[model samples]
Target: MPEVTPQQHALFEEQGHVVIGPILPPADVARLRQAFEAQAAAWAAEIDTPLDDYLAVVSQWTNVWEHNPVFREQLYHQRAAAIAAELIGCQRVRVFHDHLIVKPPHGGSTVPWHRDLPNWPVAEPRAVSCWLALDDVTAESGAMRFMPGGHREPVTRSIDFLNEAKVWGERERDAVPVAVPAGSAVFHHCLSWHTSPPNSTAGWRRAYITIYLDATCTYDPTRAAWHPMAGRVSVPAGATFNEDVFPTLGPGLSAAHLATLRGGAA
Candidate 1:
């Protein structure tokens, strides 16, 4: 597991995002890619779209861990979660959800600039997403560009991907594209303004993103009533997330605490 050094933590606090160098080795990366390919094939088979067209379509699947064993393990990746916890400055963290975004070579569309917290159902903005790249990412290959310190701004409505309108006025000039090799990851704040351009390269751009919320984070449907994952919530508004769905993780968390997290008797 790679540690988020103090300097790196400072950078994250300052810029609202920071690149964590390679956490997975070549073997792990290979296994993840294989799992994704298999799962993608299954999804393509179930859809009416032709396989060729389906592969070309930019794919965004939420909670793949619910069906894919490899992705299930990835959801609990200690290294990634630890880094997320460190970035959020929380003692413990829980899974909000995981999503897989794949931009196929040549045909993917651009994602408009937006802040994540405004689109989530959480009551607080204490969350971070660990975006692990499954392929070499470059500016020309749908790499994420961020508006540094944009998280400090007030939250706003989600952006329409079909529109090319710029939301962050003068701050757009300060946006920076972050490129990383396969097995590396970049963690960004939930409120950070970010976007990615369409892939123009011959290679695919795949990213598995796991969003971790601070343990104290509570559910709030009003934040995003139509959020895709909102239906999975079993807790009342303003209550802590259910551990069965959002497994809590932390350093030196006791067995009794784990039981409590699961809403069970310790």
Candidate 2:
């Protein structure tokens, strides 16, 4: 599994986000992309909205790991989890959730500018998310833009993506648009300010995001009624997230399996 260098850790703290590889090899990337497309098509077929209305918002299928083996493999990949632990500065990382976000060509809706932690059920800010692109992403293709060092500020209220400017009324022109090729991933702090614009390109913008939380994250009852994770665990408020749902990876990996993952060279 890959580990973060001191320099990368510094970058994350300074900017609130960092760009990582074509983290998966070409074959793995291709397989994951296919899985996401399959899931997206299945979801789009079930939507009854007009194309115009649908394009006004991005599509999100959460906890996709429960449904697809390919997604599950990618979501719990050793390298990816290791990266999350490094960026989050946590001893152990737990699965918060995973989602596939699709932006249809030419008219996908804009994702409103907002901070993630405010909308989640977790009480702490030690969560990180990896947004893996499945298509060639451009600024006009609804690529995510971030406000560098924005996570240092207090959490702000969630925004209505389709109607808002930047979080707290900042200019849209100020956010930094992060464009990367397919297979590249961006890691962002839960409090980082981010949003994506409408897709003006000719192809769909596909993304698979896996979020990891501090292993010791506890449920916040205040947001439980609406937060998705509320129903996924059996623990009470202030209790650690259960192991069955959010497995720890670094110390959890079996010795034999860990060796294989490291190409028998660990």
Candidate 3:
């Protein structure tokens, strides 16, 4: 399948998002789900909690590429990489991070609507995330909801979840639910305001999210962006992604790597 089409690019630019179905074949999806379950089980065991009773898990494996070969493989997958390249108009992109969000049955929690860039240390405004569904996601099962053109809005005051009323503002008119099937993926701009409601269904809602930023994207360390509760981490204050945080993984793409590859820089 073509990694990206002109129509897809246009849609992303206009709507600030795009959804692609079956981006991961059946086998690929199965493998990823297996990996996620294993990781989740191990994590739950360490925390002295029952795996089946967890509410919402986020950012379990920070540097996933270092621990899981499957994650490493996915980071360099041609389809994902190509799509990211096209979306960011970069010659090469690097894996910013990977997160596995699992909402267990009867998990009642709302991920407040907010933009990721405000939470990240990256200055690049072009980063994108691919939310790959490992299971069928529905409105009742905590499927992601996004506001159209939300990315265009200026960054608002950061929300403190402790104060629910203070954090969640009035819902925008363009906000809509995004229901995706297994093996499908939703592409969203980093600045898009989005969130998911609680999963009242009996089954788990599983999603594998990977964020990609162009190698040339700049970093902004003022936000002190780091993993949740992990404390501050090292990142260049004003350099592009490649100069500091993002590491190159693919082979034989060095020339294309320096210049944004998607725009034919190589």
Candidate 4:
């Protein structure tokens, strides 16, 4: 497993994102890719014909934990979970959700720029997301692009799913395109402004993302839950945190890791 460095922590604090390389070995990456492909194929068969066809051919989908234990296990994978723990400054982090964004060759549309927090049912601002590359991601292959330090800005008015340009302003100068090799990972704040271009390549561009909420983060049950699996673990509105919802990932807890879980640190 790749150890989180102080430099990485500092970069995350300053820029609201960081990239860690070689988090998964080649064999593990292969396993995850196979699992994702299998799940995607199964999902395609369940939804209505054309819609399922579209999803199978040209869109993104998530929340496979309900159907596959392998998908759930991938979310809590020891190395990836450890990285998430470090990113959120928590010893324990809940598997908020898992997402699959597959861009078919020459077909997938661009994902709009948006902050994940606004879309989430939780009120906590410290949640983190790890986007693992399942294939070589490049600018033409629909790699994620993030606006550096955009998370610190005020939350803009939320827009409907159809209006992509209206939802996010033009890309800023500090916006960086993350082109990661398969098996690497990019860690970003939940509030970070990010988007991806359409896939213009010849093969599918696939990625698996697992979102994690710090144990100290509070939940708002009133907000519309994005997934049925989301409500599976719920903490009261004003509660400091819930361990049953956000379990620890490492060998043991410590000041750095436990602080966030107890609502004592960032």
Candidate 5:
């Protein structure tokens, strides 16, 4: 992850989302691509996922860190975790979840505009996602479109990702297309409003996204329990999430904590 400067921080504060370019080295990007492909090959058939189009939403393995060594390493990668912590202004961050969203070439399903927070169990606004591109993404190739500064707006309900007819009210004009190269990432506040179009190009659009929450984040029982993580989190409502599941990724995390993370990856 590239360093987030004061200016970049300010931009993120204002826009609710910021695109950081070419963060991973070329080699790392290539390695990640291979890892993602391997993960796809290993699990694509095992998982009984149904798709209307050539799209996999929240696809592949949800806890990819526990399944693949490469993804596991990157999930807790210091620079990426550091960037996540800095962006959220938290000393420590916990893994909310990870995703391997694969949009195959031509006729990929459309992802409608919506905020990520309303879809999750976390309550506080200190969570963010690091979306790492595995393939070159363009606007035509289903790159996510974001509404700048959308996080500052009121909490909006999550909508159907396939429905595009719903109006955005007055915020439609501020939407911007985010196109980034492989090895680059788009860091967006969890509440930031975003969506992506169908992949019309010849290449596939794959992204590995890891959501990080403030270490102190706890469950909000009021939210819907659609996500599998909500079931895995052992702590009761309002309790700090269990460390074994959401390991701390930051400076001075105890060896016990690191051991927990290692055991998870192993």
Candidate 6:
């Protein structure tokens, strides 16, 4: 597994977010892209709305691993999981969920500034999201802008992405846009204030994000009672997330255990 450098660790601790990678090889990036296309096509066929219209309004697909084998394998990506654990300073980390967000060229809307922990159902704020770029991303192509050290702020209510702005009174000038090549990733804290502008370029902007929480994080329905993944949790409130659904990942997590999680996908 890959490791975060001392400097990278320090930066993440101070800034609430840090870009790392190409953690994935070109081959892995290509495979993920192919899987995305396949999943998109499947979605298009099932929806009554035109694919373009759907892309414009609902460009995100959650827990894609359940429907796609490629993503199922990627769900256990050791490098990403290891880095997440290291950054969180947790002995183990477990999946909260994964989603693919695509910003169609000149079509997608701006994602308003917000902190993720406020929207999650987990009890603690100890979590990190691995945002993997599936396409070369730039400021004009919908790359995320993050407020440095924003995670230090107290957790609050979730933002209305369609209407709210200045969630924490963060100044736009202080925020920094982060762009990366395909296969690279950005690891960000759960409470980091971040947002992305609409894609202005002709090329699509795609990102696959896997959120990992400290294994000790427990369910807290009061945080986000209507979270999509809430229904998937078998445990009661204040209990650790069900390991069957959110498999743990770390040094002692063996390949056989991951294979068990993969089942047929393995």
What are the Cα lDDT values of the candidates?
0.84, 0.78, 0.71, 0.73, 0.78, 0.86
Clash counts for the predictions, in order? 0, 2, 5, 2, 1, 0
Candidate 5 least-lDDT 10 residues: 50-59
Over 4 Å off in model 2, which ranges? 41-58, 160-173, 252-266
Q: Residues 1-266, candidate 4, lDDT per residue (tens digit)?
A: 33577778777877888889888888888888788777766666666454447564646556666568776777667777777777776666776667778888786887777778877667778788988898989989989898888878876644456855533346465687889888898899988888898889997788888888776677666554663545665555766445554454446346754554334323
Cα shift from native, residue 13, model 3 (Å): 0.9
Candidate 1 global CA lDDT score: 0.84
By summed lDDT, the worst window of 10 consecutive residues in model 4 runs over: 257-266
**TM-score-best of 4 and 5:** 5
Error of 6 at 145 (Å): 0.2
> Which of the predicted structures, 2 or 6, would earn the higher TM-score when compared with the native?
6
Residue 6's lDDT in candidate 1: 64
TM-score of 5: 0.86
1-266 per-residue lDDT for model 6 (tens digits): 32777678778988999999998999999999999987887888787767677677788989898889999899889889988877877667999999999998886888888899988889999899999999999999999999999899888798876677774453668998999899999999999999999999999999999999988999998887788988888999999999877878756444554343234222
Q: With candidate 6 superimposed using the best TM-score fit, by how many Å does residue 211's alpha carbon deviate from the native?
A: 0.2
Write down the TM-score for model 4. 0.83
The digit string of per-residue lDDT tens for model 5 on 1-266 reads: 22576666777888887778677898988898888776665565466544432134443458888889998888877777877777777668899889878778785677777788888888787898999998999999999999888788887666755554447787687787899889888899988888888889998888999999988998886775877787887888898788887888857344464444434323
| TM-score per candidate | 0.90, 0.84, 0.83, 0.83, 0.86, 0.91
- Winner by TM-score between candidate 4 and candidate 1: 1
Residue pairs with backbone overlap in model 5:
15-149
**For model 1, how does the per-residue alpha-carbon lDDT over 1-266 read when each residue is reduced to its tens digit?**
32677678778888999999798997888899999998888888887666677787638999889989999988878888877766776668899989999998876888888889988899899999999999999999999999999887887777656765666677678998999789999999999989999999999899999999988999998877788888889999999999888888757344453443333211
Model 3's TM-score against the true structure: 0.83
**Scored by Cα lDDT, where does model 4 land?**
0.73
